[model samples]
Target chain A: MSTTQPHKKTSGAYRHGDLKKALLGAGLALARQGGPNAVLLREVTRQVGVVPNAAYRHYANQHDLLQAVRSAAMSALANAIESELAKLPSINDPADFARANLRAVGMGYLKFAQDEPGLFLTAFSVPDDLQGTAVPEKAGNSGLNPYQLLSVALDRLVDTGVLPNERRMGAEYLAWSAVHGLSMLFIDGPLRQLSPAQRQIVSQRLLDMVEKGLV
Target chain B: MSTTQPHKKTSGAYRHGDLKKALLGAGLALARQGGPNAVLLREVTRQVGVVPNAAYRHYANQHDLLQAVRSAAMSALANAIESELAKLPSINDPADFARANLRAVGMGYLKFAQDEPGLFLTAFSVPDDLQGTAVPEKAGNSGLNPYQLLSVALDRLVDTGVLPNERRMGAEYLAWSAVHGLSMLFIDGPLRQLSPAQRQIVSQRLLDMVEKGLV
Candidate 1:
């Protein structure tokens, strides 16, 4: 078994105690700028002002570093969604709440994709085991988490008789699929034909269909 | 204006033949095995048993080579969908046709992603102008393309008074979004929790909703 060491630094200019955090932070910045491929171990060490060997004490290799970066990106995305959801009014109506919450999550997700395309791509590109395991606790707590937040909202919708409990998974998948697909298409696919105004109109129409489908 | 040379063989190995097509073919194979990053100029040249500079005669750069790979991937995808649709008996039945066609397209896409994640990623990663300019004659034929095939089927549904003409774009977008989203989720997202059976069930339910909405 390989023994892992903590990234405790004891030097002059590089006295940042947590070299792992520093490397991850710098890696995320690089990922945001250029993409996953840009998050090189050498460049990250250079950014953190550490010897290349120091990085190996924290991350096993570039893949490990990239995994940390990917986790950070997911955590960041979850935080953005939570922040957006918090800004909305707490509606008593379940359907209204669901609508607002879904919109907030979609907006937050789209914002992350647009603002940090490289990091966003990295977040999705990592292997499933890594993503499932390394998703931060903060991400779990945030209203930004699609599965947790959407599932809660969906349960509420079922309780309120807006959607039948039998079709909860169906409705949830449909809602997630529509918004998620549109987000990807807008950001990366062939459907970038819509102008800003047209996009807004189309987005609203999409939301309206989701609402109608649930009802 | 930069003077661009038509396909010139820098090495004697390729003569004056279809070096562009050969490079694209080799690039696709590499992409299938590794992913987009695997399709290196040097590697592709090595595969073709030609000098690295000889590839530049066919593709200006790595980006151009990737674009060709992407175009080939899309064309392959379109062909797969067309072949699947041709096998279905209910050409006039919009709901049935959409269900089968969408599944076929999604399966084809997912299979591509699973079998050749690199090429699949590259297929989506190439810039729009490259993709737009390289629109295959199959895509233009409308009958052979999945999107066009769906559109034609939807048109028939509208003519038969099953679906409203006014909501065609909305319906189209919704259908496309759901299936595309599900495909992405299955391929790269955190939906690996789904068993193959569960995935099929979910897909069928989504198609059911689309049929209900359209009708």
Candidate 2:
């Protein structure tokens, strides 16, 4: 797509304002291949057929470009979770719905990590806290980032009386820690070689642990 | 120490094969500051006052040197856990002892990550499977590596009838994932800036989740 539309025209002038979009697209492609560290300004600019100085207008430094890629990666993660949330069947029990929502959030997270390990690493590459940024850029179609989605699921548990009121506080972090840890094990740790079936079994067990332990 | 005794004599000959020890010393020092990626052969050789070829006699390449550093880092982690185990008070109840042991293991793992983030990162940098190498070089004084230490604690839980026998098979991986994920969060994720007291509280809660969930 970038090949069809260069950042600059034959007149040596800018091509309106599609430069930022092209830069982000290149950045996301780099992140998909080599993670956060690979989202270099020079490389992205080169890919977009622009000079480093032209790229600098959009990103002051490599960190700036990386942050943009990080946000996109996070949004992709939020979208993955949303995909899982969208698959829920109609249920009457609030507690059951809450449990299912929470499970879907976790399964989506693990699936994303396995299918797109590079992007998964890039999403959390930034040192942003667990209170994820809810800005529109970082949100999925549901208007919530991954952390917010997890928080909402945990809140559902409390609202449905599946989790105690006192335990509701910081419940998201506990569950996130479990699921995040499992994802790390699968992507970068010893569990990297786990077969798809094995990953599914372990993932369910881990979610069960978080579900059972939190309540 | 290498400054006092060079790896080679003035005659340009090997000095009693202490080159490997000196190289390792330099590698560990580098790893302490820069994690696994910092343990470069050229850099270590420079610090050891040796040429690249001389260093090659000990480490075939950067990966070889990194693997050695990884082993030392793993050993240090095991030692830290052993220190925690050493402080346990005498207990009459087997179940209580088993629970305390498991708690100590998790606490020690967390403490090491916070105290020595670099080495903690290095320890698991190799991506070796969770069945950690039981070689003497990677083990602590107790003749067990970190993974083995964790396994022993889980085994005690099973033997004491605290954890179900059926659940004891893959318990180590589950426990490892939770604790390891927390450590990563503290070291590289959003929890990096957490105060010590807050870290302690969250850490205890995480350990609680693992203990309650696993059982």
Candidate 3:
């Protein structure tokens, strides 16, 4: 394994070998502070202490930088879900595991939205072509992308006979739609009327419905 | 029926009486052209050929003006849904009527999202305090808000004995979550890959699940 230090030095500012990472770091910071609109190439380069034109070496334009930042945001969200899943006690019962997994993921997603609204918005709002290129490889220890995590939970349900295989896609869509819809509502809709504790109750109720439907 | 058009005219560059309405119109035009961010008070005033300060008399700031524009957008959406509901052939079956009503509402919402993406976004996004003041009152119309329309359909399910009244809120949330999630995906997510025809099928399938769950 290559040991990576916490703060490795790169070459001169203009020709820094890690300029790509620097650009993404600056872009994510800007997104967190303002929003997608704030991720301008000139300003990002300025923050990185490099000339505007030098940024072109790493990212073709502002859109390119925004895409990179968005990919990072998605990866960050996936990682949070993974961490939450790891904390749950192992269950021999697949249906119980599915419920726990869904709750963990939903809570992680909502927490991400609350903690990093700009990054969360950017992760969802970036255009498709950019997303296709920038999303991290979905293999190795990461085990799953957000979609795949949900898919696996559904697959486990099928394997354990909690849900019929014929109901796979419909079940997946239903589960996703509920949690995703609630997340959007919490982040951007009238559902903000609920206090944090109330929101938690609502989230769990939604997850319960999904598990009940699957069972 | 009282047929009354309130036409209170103002003097000079300050169109006092209908300045708010005029500003909303101008703002909507701007939003249609270039999403929500394009809606600037100065640009709206310029488009109306009024002095910049004249706009402040009607709108305290851009936030207030945007909220007005958002409310107008939602009112237009509600009207569209009402018209669609009116056009449906009368059926004796309440469940059938519920299905038809839900479909019409979904189609209207999707149409609004496609036709006026910016305004649709603003319509949902304005802060609650700002929205409460701006949402048009439908006096003597059976107290119909958009959410209530869905609630009425759910009530039909209860009346038909398809769903228990105790589960009304859960069922309502489930249905809303599915449709609202599908709408957001169509408007802003990867579902854009589907043709319009394919999208319609996906939407109908979603609605089928909601109706099925009531059984």
Q: Estimate each model's TM-score.
A: 0.81, 0.85, 0.77
TM-scores, chain B, all models: 0.75, 0.88, 0.81
Question: Lowest lDDT 10-mer window, candidate 3 chain A?
Answer: A126-135
Ordered by lDDT, highest first, the candidates read: 2, 3, 1
lDDT of 1 at A117: 64
The segments of candidate 3 whose C-alpha lies over 4 angstroms from its true place after superposition are A1-19, A37-57, A94-104, A126-143, B1-19, B49-54, B95-104, B126-144, B155-161
Write down the lDDT of every candidate, Cα atoms only: 0.67, 0.80, 0.68
Instruction: Compute the TM-score of each model's chain A versus the native chain A and list the values.
Output: 0.80, 0.88, 0.83
Best by DockQ: 1
List RMSD in Å for every model shown: 7.0, 4.9, 6.4
DockQ of 3: 0.22
Please, what's the RMSD in Å of model 3? Answer: 6.4
For A1-215, candidate 2 gives per-residue lDDT tens digits of: 75646444677756645788899999999888777657778899899887887877878777777788888888899999999889999889999999999999999999998888788887765322223322324787788988789889988999999999887755666788778888877876667677999999989888887888887
Candidate 2 per-residue lDDT, tens place, B114-171, comes to 8887788777653222233223247877879887899899989999999998777556
Q: Which number leads on lDDT? A: 2
Ranking by TM-score: 2, 1, 3
lDDT of 3 at B94: 77
